[model samples]
Target: MTFFTPKKLPKAPLLVVIITLMGAFAPMSIDLYLPAFLQIQEGLATTDSEVKKTLTLFLVGLCIGMMFYGPLSDKYGRRNIILIGATIYSLTSIASTFIANIEGLQALRLIQAIGAGACMVVGRAVIRDVFKGKQVAVMMSVVQVIMMIAPLLAPLVGVMLLYVFDSWRALFWALTFFGSMAFFLTFFFLPETYKKEERPKITIGDTFYNYFLILKDRRSLGAMLGCALPSGITFAYVTGSSYLYQAKYGLTEFEFSILFGLNIVGVIVSALLNIVCLRRFNVLTLIIFGLCWMSISGIVMLLIGGQSLIGFFLSTFLLMCVSGFIGNNIVSQIIELNYDRAGAAMALNSSTQFFVGAIASLLVTHHQELLVPVMGISGILAVIAYAGLYQPWREVRASIEK
Candidate 1:
């Protein structure tokens, strides 16, 4: 269990599978409740804006929880943190079932998101602790595949739950069940990837010092921002797409779900492409290429004026596929750059991405009538991130490595 002392790679394929499951926690939490949003609003007698705030709160909690879990895991161990977080998540998800008002539901969702965030941040950091470079990229691609499945299936599952129970609360009950299952799996099969002997001493000053060090490292910061801005773009799309599809495009929930699921197929295909590309190219190259594609897709979306479903799907699918590459590569680069403080690096990365996403989502939700502006603004952010963060990061890593 020594940090650098490998132990037969711990059944790598199986380990990858488990890690992918761990990584799916965030997507599951977000997507599972999506189809129920309108139902919940109606049931609670709240406005659309009020219901949207619940999503904002969940993201805020996710950011805060991600910031906390990384240092906690570095101090303790991965398995213990996973168990505690999963338990909290499960209990809070069940509590969500009993909430009567939008305010109460929002509170429970925030707690649930916090637990989900810990799972995601720690899971990524654990992978970094156990794997490196190309192997990490391969594993991340697999994780992307697993993560895509949640969004692909969540709405369908939510729709089915609606048919079965006619109540949105049943979705929370289902999440509780999923959380409980994840808890048992982690408790029994997830080993402590970070050994106590290898862990750095945990102290307030040391934590701040690590944060300062990471902030000072241009490559690390660049890679982090590269991931965060693109993530914000995706979050903007997620926040706005439902309204666009349902109200603007006049699609039914069933149709929208199918379209959403189809868009996720792009992620799966891109992940497969990433796995192949990682063997030949460095992570930074992959990230740049991905961002280029994302930029083009965003531009197309903006130009299309949000008029046609086909145009929307085409642009979004391309963007999501590109995201498959960016997601894993940026994280891989950051983890390599900040290997000594992998936990803190990952925590910071996750927190920043979620924070940016929350802000982007809020902006989109409030000003959704300006669809072009939302897409344009997010697209511009991606372009700035690519030019400012990713390009400079690649050059820096090359100079240092040489």
Candidate 2:
């Protein structure tokens, strides 16, 4: 039997929105607390680095949770897994608001991450189950557009919560509410996409072997690495930006949020460009162009230092835009490479990206002053990714054409 393509989908718009909402949960969990990082540290009497550990723990939970959700979704169904995950996420987020110490908060954040991870992996798997080829590309673009709105609004929402409530916990409460809404929406609207007959009847050993197979595939591995390296760069920025903007630049949390919101403009433009370009250019071309943009942005950022806000903003904007291009295309390409076990493939992809992101965040948190080191490392990774992924990807495209 053939995979379900977009032309076969009945309610395309609503389905796209639901899938996008599920994907948005992960970013919302990460970005919403960013503006309050300094405040939380000060209030809880924790070191800046310790506060950053919260983010790291969240990533750890995300990676671990992704691994489990893929197999469970395959066993049960997409809608069931999503509903369970979302409910858990909402409960954990509310629990986070009641935590008094940094450690307690960190623990709850980890649980929240786990729930978000399930949503992300399951959402992608459902999309892959329902779409293929150019339709999948279009659906991926739509999902990105929907997901982008979360990061664009997160900092601003955090800032507003701070202004109104005068406490970081308010942000957690907001997250809890959002999670609750998502949970209900998933239960009510999302239907099961995966059929029992389609699932692999495999044991633990077979699951491991399947994972190994994906890792061994040159094309799949390349696409996953290409996605992960750029994501690491973004995570480095996310982990460092609180300190960089507030402590170094002397901007208030509100001002920093406003600046962060401005950066989303770049993401919006880049995503729009990706949507337009996909009609004409192959995914490999987009990936190549994105890597070039990232390398240029990293080099420019490193060369300029913290000289002017405009320079920093321009560099960061360009970098984020490149991310917009890489994020959707990379996943789209990788998902195409592993159709039979799409859930497992997507879970591994999410796990690796978050694991790499966690490491990048930890590095930046430990070495905040050394901006050059972070940017340089990211640039080097982008170069390797281009050489490893885009080159092979081009050859694959040519062979397909021939």
Candidate 3:
């Protein structure tokens, strides 16, 4: 845990808007190009494995980059690092548009992800800096609601762009435009949230120590992994959807986008409902509920994801919606920890989730043609998170009773 306290705060609505945009960076970057995978496979002369490498490698870069950016943001400042990171990301997106080879696209996406990772980590830190426990949970749900809209719209956007340009490169160009807008908006509008006077020193040893120490805390690990494991559930659907819908179900690109948007619509509805429910329930209770929903959904998917299209679709929708709840609640628990060390806590919370989620995605991607693995991983991880967090829940209850 850290001792650094926040400085004065900015206006709340504006701050949420900015942070939501930062949060949107990752999903938009990802979902925007998903509809074009088949086209890219043809245009770049790449195999499905190679095309999928772009997704996995981007996640890898995001994981590694966040590990470093968390400590650096704590030492330096959120605004500076975010700007630097977004600039790099925007530049890479632009560069990706011009790359003529699959290897070059893969390399650029990795670097682009490194830059995007800054936004993902620091946005949460900014929230933790200003808001306390319950407020943080509510705000996170609000943020998740706004951010969820990106994926809902992104595939549709990608399809329309593909229709107009008739090329996969159009998606990269769109990313470049968005990235440029983010750079200018952040530069002109965003303020530094972390206080300078109370900042922690930046050192390699201290950073690693802080990271390990957080991991060592059972409660902290519980919260981090609880949020992370569901990510695999979502990513599994994401990585396999084009194949699942197109090859197996015989959906066209336009229809696939509509179906994907329908699932994301579930996420938005859940997030909205979560904002209302947060007023009456504690974070842990909601997390358990979400986990239960995920477990049920996964079991159903395993039993039916391959045989019944409606069953698979409904189960996938449940998994997506539950993800928002689990992540918001888990991160709220992390934010409730030592405020001084909120940056490091958030970093640990984020990087681990990405790392774990990345592995989960990689595993499922390897067997994308199958639904059994997705069901097992998604269902098992939900149960695992619930079991792990139950101890922490008991501890909280004990402390409250005393």
Give the candidate number with the greatest lDDT.
Answer: 2
What's model 3's TM-score?
0.94
Best-to-worst ranking by TM-score: 3, 2, 1
Give the clashing residue pairs of candidate 1, or none: none
**lDDT value for model 2:** 0.80
Which parts of model 1 are misplaced by more than 4 Å? 1-14, 390-402
Instruction: Write the residue-wise lDDT of candidate 1 on 82-165 in tens digits.
Output: 777888899999888888899998898888888988888888988888877678778888888877898899888988898899
The number of clashing residue pairs in each candidate reads 0, 0, 4
How does each model score on lDDT? 0.78, 0.80, 0.79
> Candidate 2 clashing pairs?
none
Task: Compose the digit string of candidate 2's lDDT tens values, residues 1-402.
Answer: 023222233377777777887888877888898998989999999999989999989999999989888877776668778877888899998888888899998898888899989998999999888887867777788788778899889998888889899999999888888888777666656657887788788775676567789988877887788777776767887898888888888999888888887777778778888899998988777877887778887878777745776777777776777676787888887877887778888899899989988988888878886554575467558658657754665666777899
**Clashing residue pairs, backbone N/CA/C < 3 A, model 3:** 2-340, 2-341, 3-340, 4-340
Q: Estimate each model's TM-score.
A: 0.93, 0.93, 0.94
Candidate 3 local lDDT, 334-375, one digit each (tens): 767646777778777777767765776677567775545665
The stretch of ten residues in a row with the least summed lDDT in candidate 3 is 1-10
